[model samples]
Target chain A: MANITNDAAKPERLQLLRVLGPAHVWALGVGIVLVGEYMGWNFAVGKGGMIAGLVACWVAGLLYTCVAMIDSEVTSTVAAAGGQYAQAKHIVGPLMAFNVGLFLVMAYTMLEAANAITVGFLLDTVAGMTGHSGLHQQPFIVLAIMFLAWLNYRGVLATLTFNLVIVAVAFTAICVLFFAIQFGASNVPLDFSAVTEEPLPYGWLGIVASLHFGLWYYLGIEGTCQAAEEVRSPARSLPYGTMAGIMTLLIAATLTWYMCSGLIPWEYLGQAGTPLFDAARVTGNVWLMVLLFIGTIFATLASANGCINDASRAWFSMGRDRYLPSWFGAVHPVYRTPYRSIVFLVPIALIFALGAPLDQVVTFSILSGLLGYTFMTFNMVMFRRKWPLDTIKRGYVHPFHPLPTIILLILCSSAFFAVFLGYGTQLIAMMCFYIIASLWFHFRRYQYVRRGDQFTMPWPRPQGY
Target chain B: MAYEPKKQGLAAQIFDVVTLLVLTVGALYVPLYMGLAGAAKTPNPIENPTWEALGQNAAEQRQWEALGITDPASVNDMITARFDYSFSWAALIIMIVSVVGYFVLVVRLSDREYREVLDERFGSKRKGG
Candidate 1:
């Protein structure tokens, strides 16, 4: 644990270790990465989707992990709470940092909005059973946001511990459902024929298609590092939690999903509106369906709760840095929660829920986050080569420094390529947004700067040898 | 066009609901309108040529001649004879291009923000200022 009073030892902000631990943080990672999207990836993409997604994930994963790893060295690294904002200050200076910080606030807030909508989606399912009308009414949003806000106002450690309990119960229910699906297999034909006879529906294009769904598994990864100060042994835990959640779910979830697809028959799997839920219903055991409902609801709940908590932190950090209003920086004096920041995201979340369709929100959030992952990969490479290091030198070294780093760079680049190849103009439009913002900030940050003088791009991050 | 998340306030919500309704309608209605209906129970591919011949080949012949096209209405009887087998394929293509296209767009925009975050997260540590 860090000594809070020893300001002279390392003064600017509070250290991260006081708040989180390896196990708890890993759960946070798991909470975000494990979701319906993983199931979609498995069923839709099939075997080939797994190969391509995993390969891309491996590449991008290293880059993301490297970002967290290099971060271990900073006493109070950039600015307290303003993650990328602080990192930007190091590499590009205040203007770029200011722009990036604003971008992050938008990104995380949108994510919060999307997750709140997800809460409505899950609850809407509950509403279906009771014949309730318009559960998505404004009152529900008020209730959900306020509840989440209250949960957060309780403080970081408490919020995490509460989430952990919720997540644990969720996982236990998930285990029961998994077993039911596996056991209900009356026709457990161990034949590997499905891969050959029909072969995954989309063929080559399927792999690229799968990335859309598959990438969702990696969405919550960045959140884990947001509380670097709260974590127990961040040097070790951050890396472990971030990557483990990804790799484990990749392997475990993939196998389980494959089992479902292979065993369930393509027609049934494809047709079921709620495939997992439908699968449970077919088991001839009402008990199993009940269990699956529990699993799915909890999955959505954990996602919503965990996302709101992290979203507030991102806001608080940004606010504390004076990038946004200083009001965003407020922490509950008693609970040490980001009260103002968390409260602020509420209506934005409601509007998001009320406005956008569900699938778009999910896909949009994942896409935006993966873009972040690509940059992280490049950062890892640059950090290894260009970033300066002192107190924290070697955290988690990429197995092959330059090569893996290079591969990660390519992989991250591919995320851009994948999105564009898969999306085309929409991708272009999205980039134009940031480009417009980036340019606005650039011109505003540096008045009357010529294109020739714009040769230099941002500043430094660390690497391990 | 430069894409912003919401064009205006209430308009955004209206657009969202409208877009979703259209997409869902398309997803559902397209298949019904075009998807192969009443696929004459395709028997498992078997070694028996007579059974196979009795199925598609014989059925295809009926499709052309049954319309009394002995003189063949200008176009090749074979062309019309060819069963309209591509409706389902076309429908599948549209559905896929749509769902995947929708998300890919979302992911790309998300990536832009994500990348900047990564740069700053790391950039902060490098300078140590």
Candidate 2:
């Protein structure tokens, strides 16, 4: 065990392969998020009607645009596996870093669990439809989690390449659905009347409430930064991949909203389980339905697979920094994956998938993501304050400095209010949970953490000496 | 071990472990015990309900009912339920102040410590004479 620990501490062993390019990073980010365009985002419509939903989508897009710009800037320079966690460590302090790491782990794990559960249920539904009943969801859930984990543990290139293909297929399905409906291929004509009639059924306050659900449109896009260490050229690839991912999501989101709202009534669209699939079904075309069904499944699987890659990386980074046990930091000798961290998270995710209520699981994941975004606002501010522009060679410098930071803060605070308006208790509970975890880390974990080793980037001293 | 971890007394380690366990449970369980977790209790079905099953067709609704969703309309209502819209100003203000205040404090403290590092590494900056 001691020799293994010594071996794990070697710099060569600790390093992740720099095989990933911009496309892999794009696949990682978009693979995790494209699931949103297929479902979940419509919940905003349920909260605030059609107009509020559209407004929320655009507003949320603005919030994430700020996030992507800030993330691109810091991630290009930091170029680490922990993403925002690494940014917080270098820019803020240990406590904030620990919290950010926890946020990433919890956010991605819960999301992975949610995706696995969805996959299990999807397969079970298929079974029931085909005259088979009592196909228990647990084995399928376990299988999905295990399959994805095994894929991740094998290698990064294969995993992300697979993600790229399925994500492309799912994204193409959305585009096809949009164009087919646009060309009047659907027997039913698209209806724009719903937009004008009862635009804001519940008033502007509903917009505030809807903002919480709006996040589903682009929740995990910031996850692109987790691939910083793996990218061939962190400065160039991280920014390019992240920006491209966000643009793709933006177009897909707009197309999804347009197609679903035009095809289905607002009342039903607001509460749809699978809005895109339903839209295809409404088109009265068998092939469209089949294609959309495949799209939904692929999106779910891709999300789970991406979540595994990200959560393990964040956990592995934390372990490497001594924020968690060093046992989890070990990279596989051959596969070059954070094999232990990948395996450790499997049971945690499986437990949540099997036992917890789905809505509660989703709420936990969303709140954790919200906390990460809030941290990015301060992280960007401090990063610029410490490093300045000319002090370091930034791979990509965000155009506006404090403007994006300020906008992100306001939007983040508004999202906090939106969560408060709806899920007041879970919001507070999540805060309390993080607070307790923070206390644990500050009091215990910080001592074991080495300050010198934490700042591993090849950058000069921060300014203002 | 080439890298030695910081040594702590057994009592302190145990205390930290116990505190983490108890507080973590309290943080997660109290709200759940208070019935505070049920913001949206919709069935997260993998497939979308058909139009006929959404009470658009009487026979299909019956079939759905037999399949276990006794009342599709209630489920619809639950899924489409909007927030009350009115939030307590006190809660919102407190939340904003707490978050922004925390960020401000972290930034200020981190700034001081960071400068201390810069001073150690680059030598203390001499003021212009």
Candidate 3:
């Protein structure tokens, strides 16, 4: 092979600043997902009752554990803004990379829209309780999206620093609620029998279906890799931060399941708009209620904030590679942020938040996420096949490689089945949507993409080609 | 210098705009047309509303008795589990084909494009190229 050199002078390219550490990475990942503990996970209980909900939680946890381990190993080496999209580009090729990039952007953007709508509904709920029932939610939703967009537009450091504080506070509130209900000054009573009162109400199939809501428990934890380019040291920070984020989510998911299941009947708990808030309301302690309410709002805001960060990065990366319009590729010279992409996504998120039904919005987000995880399964297999061990220097190597890959594939298939149960038509429709998108990319978008220049990593040729 | 992408032709831009409009509408309407719209919850009120009475109420107790859901083992009869899981072989086959076919196309296209990149960056005489 011919030797390559950088002796020729190169033009200066504005880039995202690398100023983050493991803590910021943790905050980015956990911030995007902590909202799950406050509201969504209880849907599993409605699907299969407490025991099945617990099973689904552990199963989804195992799925995400594989995601984190595999993502960490690959991300430590790829180290780019696009996360899995970057991995797909280097390990697979343009078509898969384009789809993965679209998946990341769609998933995070839809989640951001959902978070904004949730924030609006939350404020309206607080208003209804205070006797001001006719509050307009649109302004609140618009404000939430615009403010977070502004934060992201400022810089990554400020955005993630704010995320760290709120995420820490939100996580701490969950711990406080757990400890208070378990052994606090509150005189609130608990019904420990309520947990096991109705076990596996839907049987085995219910456990399978519950895997859908179980996803809400740790949905966006893989977002940590979106920060790879911005991290001070991708090799050290990506693995450490992502693993720590998943571990924290596991504990948080369990605590949330336990506390809510103990306090409320599975039937009512499953249908609650905000189970943690309802768990606090059952206590009749005004202070605890206020804390949990704040926790819910902060968690939603944190999620929207992180979604903006990740979605914008993915869009910006794809833009940089000309997979999309080149207009979105610009990084802010002064702020060192993906300003164009951030600004461009605000209106898309706003329309979804204000126009679409909340459930559908969330369903779209979840399915998009599932597609990304499914992509990771193949991405990991290809990464191993193309660049085997010791072929290139790796920052971190996850043990039992094929094991994690197999587990991820199984869990992903199960989740697909779960989505199919309730959303069969929607599942098929989303597949068609992506197929159309892939066709568009293949015929229309491929020419704009710099084919030879798309490979950004410094690695040797694949073993087989 | 970083690799910046070339500009698109007008036809591509028009295709982009038209496809985006179609997809956005499809994303919004397909679910609704498919009956995936969110269902409004029916208010289930109980007498003497209290935290203790939230789940264990006369109405739910009646529901439990009527459905014979007194024990955890038979609780499978509860309402949420009523989703019809009747397997449709045709639908499953269509889904399998759609997904698998997409992957097949991706892999085949990727092989061709990836080799072209290798040949451009390193001469075709190179072993992998």
Candidate 4:
């Protein structure tokens, strides 16, 4: 039998724990919320599907909580840079890990696209204010993507702080609204009666459609897990930070929905290019609105930067393992950052940025996450015996034991696949074909791993010993 | 043996709490400043019996006169929107408490933990390298 482990390859240098503290870590959580959880979908959805829209976010929140726990466990022990790919590789066989590595490129690249497009959406409003329309037109979005790409390519990461400064600043915009609510009574106390799903916005396909649009809201939480290797002390900070980030975003998102439901109503929001900004006019405070706008700009830039870092790291790992071009693994000698791979990611992301502002991109991103998450959940189950607390020194004992893990796998996987069933009939068929092709390519890459030269991947089993 | 943990000073703790509250209120500004909520409640509809009786009167031709005319010019005039409404005292105080509390606590913490953080960050990065 062919050896399955990557033992023969020289090990990469171990990462030193940088002096990142609670606040820095906390900022990452806030970044995830502002970027991932704070993208405006209330205005994007049609009126009647309001009930489903609300429920979808709630489900997403619970899912986020579950992913955080499991991710903390996986990341606390594993290196942070490679993140889910590293964790998945540990528990599952190498073939699945190979599949995960490829998809991460797809996943992260698309997320960068979503961020650019989202900023483009907000740009439309900013343009109108300056007495110009279509300023956020696709050409500008392209320029923004190129600028972002240049930032990544130009050796900016080495000196960059991990603190998501812009997102955090905008996160403060919520205080102004809270004050207003206390100052004046509500016009309506959340009349769920007016809620409708009749025309159902996008019709029977709305839920799946929204799921795609919705997935963008949860994009960058994965970055925190990837930072596990560089964390001060994973035992305390990792678990708390991951859970805290998810809960914080969940609370903020639910509150945003609850407050906005009757205030702006769905129709006006759906049609309004700058829905939130429009609402700001009612508050009668230009300074407050200015703060929000500036905060949003900060939010996008920080999130984009974080995404580039995480995705490039994933590219670095796969390249080092020989699944991708080895050139991508080249780290800057002085800076210790993956300069080349990050540059490569920019163009891939730009393709999606220039694509029409279809909600389908969000669906594709979430579907990929779910597909990868399935492998992650299954791997944790498979490796339960090997990494049991007795074996691993700092093992995380999940609060509700096997049951929650099992439930998480079932629900999260089902929801992920649910979208495919809903709208991915053709795409799923194509994906199934490509996955088969991927497996074939895997085996073909390693003739030694297959018996009788049929075909094979270097799917070596990893022995912890 | 594990090192003995240093508890944050009362003043520092106060600052931390205040800062966190500031952050919370600050974030909530997104919803507030956007006018997605906090609509001024409509005062109860003016339900005077005379006004109701005036609508039913066959003297509807003189309904404009029959109704109180004390504020005719004001009623007919185009009302301008005022953006500079006085903020409620409660709104003003809660905000002040949170912001002031944050500054005070931060000042206290600076006096206490500044040495430790500096030693850990810039000092250690320089020394260890």
Model 4 Cα interface RMS deviation (Å): 26.1
Instruction: Give chain A TM for each model in order.
Output: 0.77, 0.95, 0.96, 0.82
* Candidate 3: stretches off by over 4 Å: A1-12, A184-188, A192-195, B1-6, B9-18, B33-87, B125-129
Please report the candidate that would top DockQ against the real structure. Answer: 3
lDDT of 1 by residue, A159-256 (tens): 77766776666566556666655665322322223345445444565455445545554566566666665665666776676666555555545444
Q: Per-residue CA lDDT of candidate 2, range B1-129, in tens?
A: 112458555566456545654654465457777877645524443235554444334433332343335555545554344545666788877766756665565456555544443444444565530
Fnat per candidate, as a fraction, reads 0.01, 0.26, 0.34, 0.00
Candidate 2 predicts chain B with a TM-score of 0.51
- Tens digit per residue, CA lDDT, model 2, A210-320: 888788889899999998878889999999999999999999999988888777666667766677877786777778988988998899899999999999999888877
Which of the two candidates, 3 or 4, achieves a greater DockQ against the reference? 3
Question: What is the C-alpha lDDT profile of model 3 across A170-239, one tens digit per residue?
Answer: 9999999988877863444555564455566567888998898899899899999999889989999999
Q: Name model 4 segments beyond 4 Å from true.
A: A1-19, A43-48, A136-139, A146-163, A185-193, A196-214, A268-275, A281-284, A425-430, A433-437, A446-465, B1-129
Candidate 4: residue A222 lDDT (0-100): 56
Best by lDDT: 3
Report per-candidate DockQ.
0.04, 0.23, 0.27, 0.01
Better of 2 and 3 by DockQ: 3
Prediction RMSDs, each to the true structure = 12.4, 5.4, 5.4, 20.1
* Candidate 2 runs further than 4 Å off: A1-12, A124-135, B1-30, B40-82, B101-129
Q: Give the winner by TM-score: 2 or 3.
A: 3
Q: Which ten-residue region of model 3 chain A has the weakest summed lDDT?
A: A1-10
| Each model's backbone clash number | 23, 0, 0, 27
| Candidate 1 ranges beyond 4 A from true positions | A1-17, A36-85, A91-111, A123-142, A185-194, A263-275, A388-395, A444-465, B1-129
